[model samples]
Target: MAEGRRVKRYADLIKRVVSEVIEFKLNDPNKGMVTLTRVKVSPDLRIATIYYTVLGDEKQRAKTKEVLNRSRSFIRSEIKPFITSRWLPELRFFYDETMDYAERIDSLLKSIKNDADSEEE
Candidate 1:
């Protein structure tokens, strides 16, 4: 329970810090309104997986990923002050497809509904 709490706390901190870094600190215009969707921390707090989404297509997302990865060290350094660990955790940025998947499912459901209505008519 304690470990869970610790992990949650750290994950929240990492997410907030990284979000700010990406939004305000990074000078890359190619980031394209990147939004941090979630953050997960290892049990020992040595690794943080940051999930994010871009406000564009696959190419923009790919560029965002590349930009973030390139700026990982800078982001980590910026957030180092907020981390209480003896060593900063390894930051890994990943594209979160949850929103995209949800959108796809929604579109499919709407299509199905339309088909059913037409068939009934």
Candidate 2:
């Protein structure tokens, strides 16, 4: 649907804004080395799911999430002026664990490959 495309476009726009504009521009200590992973917007573009990853342990990740949540209002206000949409999508933060899962799978495959090579030898 055309609406879905618009929503996706908005999601990408938000991702770019958060990464290039907010992350780089804002000097927030509590952000904690956060990386914007992905964004998913609803069909109506009223709600957005922003996936992020933080480079640290669980506690640090939690802290970063809290910091981001606290700054949500400010971020919304700051981005509103730039966006031309009638309704700014509500931002929701989620931790992206895909990288960790991929890493584990890669390591397992490497170990299996090493075993195969050893058997061949």
Q: Which 10 consecutive residues of model 2 have the lowest summed lDDT?
A: 18-27
Question: Which candidate comes out best when scored by lDDT?
Answer: 1
Error of 1 at 40 (Å): 0.3
TM-score to native of every candidate shown? 0.97, 0.84
lDDT of 1 by residue, 1-121 (tens): 9889989998999999889988888999888989899999999899999999889888998899899999999998999999998779999999999999999999999999999999999
Looking at candidate 1, the ten consecutive residues that score lowest on lDDT are: 16-25
Per-residue error for 24 in candidate 2, Å, reads 3.7
Top TM-score prediction, candidate number: 1
Superposed model 1: Cα runs more than 4 Å off = none
Predicted structure 1, TM vs. truth: 0.97
TM-score for candidate 2, residues paired by index: 0.84
